[model samples]
Target: MAGHPLKKIQCESIARTSGKQCRAKGYLKKSGHYRCRFHGGASTGAITLEGKLIAYKNLKQFKNYTDEQLLIWIQNKLQKSSSV
Candidate 1:
């Protein structure tokens, strides 16, 4: 996926957070968003510095979501994961 335009954000974010550029890629929790393993763990959404939803495919696509949203998604995912 190195030359894939759509995976650029994932690569950039990984580089920004890890301090080392990477080409690894994975599906964004839901569909459209993308993130490297280091930053991809049940994210709910990505926001701007002032706090605005920039992109979100699922509740697990963000690292910081509103309190209400976080509570609901966390509860749901936890329950589902446990059941599985």
Candidate 2:
């Protein structure tokens, strides 16, 4: 896949409804389809540390941001979520 480097880390979860394990892998804008490492080749959807769905375009815009910054952003989004 393109020249962009793959993300070092990834997050995984199981869909309660479908029972299908879902994994999110970070990829470059050139990556055609957004998918987990196992099933599909690449991914298009960007997922935050806290599991928020950020637009793929936005991900490209902030691709230069440090991992710490991205983690903080994800934490902030998680903070806004309703307590379970």
Q: Please name the candidate that would achieve the greatest lDDT relative to the true structure.
A: 1
After superposition on all CA atoms, how large is the RMSD of candidate 2?
14.3
Predicted candidate 2 versus true structure: per-residue lDDT over 5-49, tens digit per residue: 464333344556688656455333344534455645455444544
Worst 10 residues of 1 by lDDT: 48-57
- TM-score for every candidate vs. truth? 0.26, 0.30
lDDT on C-alpha atoms for all candidate structures: 0.56, 0.52
Cα TM-score of candidate 2:
0.30
Every model's Cα RMSD, please? 14.1, 14.3
Top candidate on TM-score is: 2
Clashes of each: 6, 4
